[model samples]
Target: MAADPAIRAIAALDDELRRGMYEFIRDARRPVTRDEAAAAVGISRKLAAFHLDKLVAAGVLHATFQRATGLRRVGRAPKVYEPTGGDIRVSLPPRQYDLLAGILLDAVLAAGADEGARDAAVRTARERGHEIGADHRRRTRPGRLGAERALTIATGLLESHGFAPARDSPRCVRLRNCPFHPLAERAPDTVCAINHAFLDGLLDGLDARSVTARLAPQAGECCVRLTATT
Candidate 1:
């Protein structure tokens, strides 16, 4: 099978020079010539051309030919590069965090009483989380699951969802990655509340009465942690 185009595009940026050129091109706000890209990154024009072609092949950029602006003499329009502006995301186990963001975005646009958009987003997140929880329970048909059993099950689900949950002890589980990153970093109060509510609803649906989701924000990790109420 062929590699995913978006992933390939992102992977192409692993090189420091290519990544720098990508940034310069993206920020230039217009098509950039190989000379300009090379100068910006302090690389040879020949080398820049090679990397730029790689970017174009990976679909991270588009190449166009245009005459130099304010120049009367033109032998040929020089090939210039520009960003494709496509949303590209890659996760190790793959996560649909954007799906959650989109759901919350729809709720916000519906413009319920929460003009601030926080309440509406939080409510939607809780409902969505509950729906997921209920669906998982229905699929598995788990019976009389306790906190330990429920935690084990929830960790598996959370890991696939990109929460990166780690069981620190029998009573506590800490999340190592926030799937709703960048956004969570930008707006912690609203986003973190949504996370807490979502996890709480998940536990409710799972009937995990002894495990509780708590807000214990830490640097470089998820805002919410699960603790055994018992």
Candidate 2:
């Protein structure tokens, strides 16, 4: 039941943004200018800049620069902004693993490997890993090397493949990306299989037996540790 630190951080950030956005638009009488928004939210202009930037990035606010009142200046008026058109809409909630977990569960049930899904998932993952390795072999040009020298190459390969692999510790590398955790909610087996496939492919030739994973339910911190085999 412990919260995943990563998930907690993201959730906190999302909440802060949501709160600031709400206050920024509360006046409802006029367009909420970014500076006005900052004052309303009780945050500094610079801090406001970052949050507003996120809002813009999330499509929650649209920006248009126009002239504002300038003090003791004979040049063009300072630029100002306000919420434009209509109230901005949030495209989607923060990315969570709920949906991904469900997908995995469904995949397993559909595959009819409920009881033995874990093993089946591992095999599926292994195959997928092999395919990825083969693809790497095809796409990579020259400078061929053995597995020992290929660690860096493999790491890069996994990154490009969307694994977001990071070295969490000396001997353990953790995976930070997974688009399937939401599916685990509905199809845990499927998610497990998909995760297995991902890690298998990612750590291919790095000693398969050395890998182990821990998936937090609804925490969105699914991690895989690449440990050395005894």
Q: Could you report the Cα RMSD, in angstroms, for every candidate shown?
A: 8.4, 10.1
Measured with C-alpha atoms, the lDDT of residue 215 in candidate 2 is 46
lDDT values of the candidates? 0.86, 0.52
Query: Which candidate number maximizes TM-score?
Result: 1
Model 2 lDDT per residue over 1-230, tens place: 76443344345347665455545564454545566777876777777777766655444455555554454656654333444334322212223343334434554655553556566555555655666666666676424454334545555765654456667654555556654444556776566556665566645533333444444332544444344333
List of clashing residue pairs for candidate 1: none
Ten contiguous residues with the weakest lDDT in model 1: 92-101
Which whole-number lDDT from 0 to 100 does residue 3 have in model 2? Answer: 47
Candidate 1 deviation (Cα RMSD): 8.4
Question: After superposing candidate 1, which stretches have Cα over 4 Å from the reference?
Answer: 1-88, 92-97, 109-111, 114-116
